[model samples]
Target: MNTVTRPRILVVGAGFAGVECVRRLERKLSPDEADVTLVTPFAYQLYLPLLPQVASGVLTPQSIAVSLRRSKKYRTRIIPGGAIGVDLKSKVCVIRTITDQIVDEPYDYIVLAPGSITRTFDIPGLTDHAFGMKTLAEAAYIRDHVIAQLDLADASQDPVERASRLQFVVVGGGYAGTETAACLQRLTHAAVKRYPRLDPSLIKWHLIDIAPKLMPELGEKLGSSAQEILRRRGIEISLGTSIAKAGPEEVTFTDGRVIPTRTLIWTAGVVASPLIATLGAETVKGRLAVAPEMNLPGEDGVFALGDSAAVPDLAKGDGAMCPPTAQHALRQGRHVADNVIASLRAQTMKPYVHKDLGLVVDLGGTDAVSKPLGIELRGLPAQAVARGYHWSALRTNVAKTRVMTNWLLNAVAGDDFVRTGFQARKAARLKDFEYTDAYLTPEQVRARVEGARAPE
Candidate 1:
């Protein structure tokens, strides 16, 4: 390899994968050897596993948001923006800043770890009414919005309005939906005591999914256990059902049940970042196809991983791809970085093979479920495994300390049902956060890269 200046390495997305990749690159290579730049909408890597706690007010946003610049490798340039387009042929990446400025950044090598966004469908009124729990702002907004519902219900004399305000419909019984319903249900259960005028039974939480069970990843036994716990707490668990129609005040399920509720949380699933489609590459299951070494075949100086890329599940040996998870993302990020460094030095690169560690679901309170190293656990034991995994996943000590402190404080302190009125100014909607409408066509991408025409 021959070069006058150091290779400019551009990493898209400051998520678990992207952050770990940059950190590894920073540690392995000096600034004089290779320049590293990261593009992300935020300066912090969100500890997404803890986002439910944030939505429940158990943990503050800052506690789960790990800082990017605090690492020992401080030379990496942080570009606070999201990648809108990538011109692989010209080796230029187009970025849209937080302020909406479009800029083109040239890179000698690029890492695509753009993570994911909430998956939504064509359900009527879904975008305008439903809330999401993917981002930090969404979690905080949800916390405020849920509390606001209780406050509004307490003050309103109209039973109709009060009933609607107290009921919450959370669609999708995956980990996010399950944990969200569980945690927030506990919040309202403990909170209704403050509202002496309000009927406790009016506060209802419905966890619905098209799937047959709750958190099937936790396995059947634990999944059944989670369902029983939620049922005991009076949470209406509806399986094999999804939102047929959604409105500001009510949601109609596919099973012909119309539920009145002011709050609707959509956690059905997540698709790869829209940026992944801009590359005009073949994808496997909505994710960019990548080699086990995390490199794009036939394309030099390019790598993709995390939820955005279909990383082969080498450990499974079943022609399968690694599941989109924080655990896999963290490992992929670190391994991809090492592979990138090897490419820079013209050295041999190794394939990424990771076995599944386990799964954990914090149902809030003392109840939880986990499967660590194939051993199923429930109750207190599961809670420890769940928390221990999250605590260790946090990159910085500051984040760990804050999260631990928040956990301790929340356990000891009594519930304070206060609404910040976040939704009063502007209701939290699905469309506001992730820009699902933004994406470039294959023709547009080819034109941009080939210099046939400017990207729109």
Candidate 2:
């Protein structure tokens, strides 16, 4: 008689991918059959779709963050840390805990849904002059920074200083960048009413990117309509342009135009986390290459998904790959979990195949755009659909209720726009939150090993 060891599944990164993976695994697997664990830096899974709302004061910071412990009902243990490296051959992962300790955890099966990090360019002074909009910290920083800018503009004696303090530049024209600009501009408009000394006209917002059109992925017609609404609301949309240089008090664009501004938001794009490349697996554009089943090819009991994995879009012909978005990530996570359980049972695993469901872009206030099921929508009705869709998409009741309450309060009483006073006056640069350079590669690791042996 052979005694079967309980199958152990370890999910890394608690973003859409990791969280959904564990959620599905718990639902499918019997307690006696498998043991599941999730590793994440935080106890909550942040609803990234509403990050722009949080930055713009439409929602509070906690509204978008759902507690993972409260949401998960299964026996899965949550490890509070980040997976820094993986030893695929040994089936061990090196994780860095929040307390700055390194530990190794072994697993029978590993789900590499580590997600992506911000991809910054090599623009002059960008690392030192720009702010990021990727994480909770960055979003909170932007909120306080915007309010502080208004306060500074009100107090400045020199017109140039005041103008610089009031001018805001948002780089990137994707949904994230556009929504952030729209929401922040609304906050400024609402908050400046309190500062009688400040002129709302002095507050200028410029959205710049090298893309010929804003959100071309959203199809042409809806994209144009969304851009028009933003333009009508006093937003300067500079297409086919990018920042040439950034300074403490000015931003120089590729069009040979320079604007004096202290606020520079960088939201250009994202790449897979450096941890993926460390696994010594095939990678596409920094993302781990995985099969349609979300399993890494040639690797046993290993899988990846979300922004960190290059998942093929089997639904689309011509060998196309899915774009990194929350919608796809959430679905991919559930599919991967099912596959993991199938593997344990020695059953057939299913491939991840889901058609693109449409996208929604909230432009703050009663202005928005959406394309659900190939139908294009815009204006107020679209805004309602967008908010409703996102509110329903939230994972937890507490999160849903909090977000709805914030939206209702804002609608009734308007935004407070008061700076949280956290991370204020502390100028944040692009490099402060994200690292642009590639981390230690195999060659570098080899050299480090050789040096350590030779010297000490």
Candidate 3:
């Protein structure tokens, strides 16, 4: 008697699109239909939009991190690793496990959604000096770092050193940079009140971006409103500016203005995962090129989405691709799963079209700007809309409850501004987290796989 081998479905990354895809596939596909697997270092899907809150102590890290195994709908076999390379022709994916073991995973169907890394330029001392906001660890590290600055400044006698320690320079005017600057600044403000000896006026935050306007996607009125709110809070907004050089204690702006600060948070932009380069496929703006159906052009049983895929935007209907946003990535994930199942069942696959959902920029506290459903809102109303949207988008009820509870507790009791001593405990630099040189070459992948199978 011979048993029929089930089709293997492997998914890369646990980001917004990758998590959604695995969830949908797990729900739709039966055990006999396919065996699903997911490759990721962590078993949780990070709610990236609220990372700033984590750094600001508004929300705990665990509150925003949705566990993958929490739901009973999960049926996929999770592999604790990150993809290093892909052999498209051989239907194989090479993954670097948490233990540093290289394993080759074979699949009949594959979904590439390895997400993105913080895009950095060749600015001097950037990798060694700057902090990042892309991961939970980074947020936690930043929280401790920001609070530590206050501690050190309070203990210091030198006025120049205190001023430098009190200053923070945030690069990028996009959502992450803007929100991070706003949230962390609020943290410092509430924190400085605790130190009677430290001058509150010495604490300064400079928000600089190459773009002329802040959050241009939020439209003119909403963008201006956010800028005004931040400006009113004493934030220095330097428009049409970028970092020329990043140093240990200073960052020189492109406009030749030098800022002396130990904190340099880079939230400029993101590039597609280095995994995209392994496929050696065409890309649109650093992302893997995919059809409107979220499948590779001529590659059989392979699909890509999220920040790594340049999925065509049919709703725009002008040869445009979907922007790398959670809204688009989640929707695309569901659609790709449907298409994959449709393909297996010999049914028609549908194209992924995204409708405009406007934008939201939470400036911490009651200050926020939103253009939900094309209606511009500001202050408390916008904050409500923004938080409501994010809260509703969380995958689990437990996560929502924790986040809401955090908000309530923060409102009633406020923060203690305690530094967990992560600065001396760990290296929280940009290079320490995102290693640009970590990916494996194609030859190295083949050698490792062949060597592993040699014993057989």
Best candidate (score: TM-score): 3
Instruction: Please provide, for model 2 over 191-277, each residue's C-alpha lDDT reduced to its tens digit, 9 standing for 90 to 100.
Output: 889999988899999999899999997898999998899898899999999999999989999999999999999999888998887
Per-residue lDDT over 11-65 for candidate 1, one digit per residue giving the tens place of the 0 to 100 score:
9998889999988998889778988999988899899988999998899889988
Give candidate 1's whole-model lDDT. Answer: 0.90
lDDT of 3 by residue, 278-344 (tens): 7878988889989889889889999999999999889888898899999998998898999999988
Candidate 3 lDDT score at position 299? 93
- Looking at model 1, residue 91 earns an lDDT score of 87
Worst 10 residues of 3 by lDDT: 444-453
In model 2, what are the clashing residue pairs, if there are any?
Answer: none
Off by over 4 Å in 1: 1-3, 71-73, 446-456
TM-score of each: 0.97, 0.94, 0.97
**True-structure lDDT of candidate 2:** 0.87
Q: How close is candidate 3 to the true structure, as a TM-score?
A: 0.97
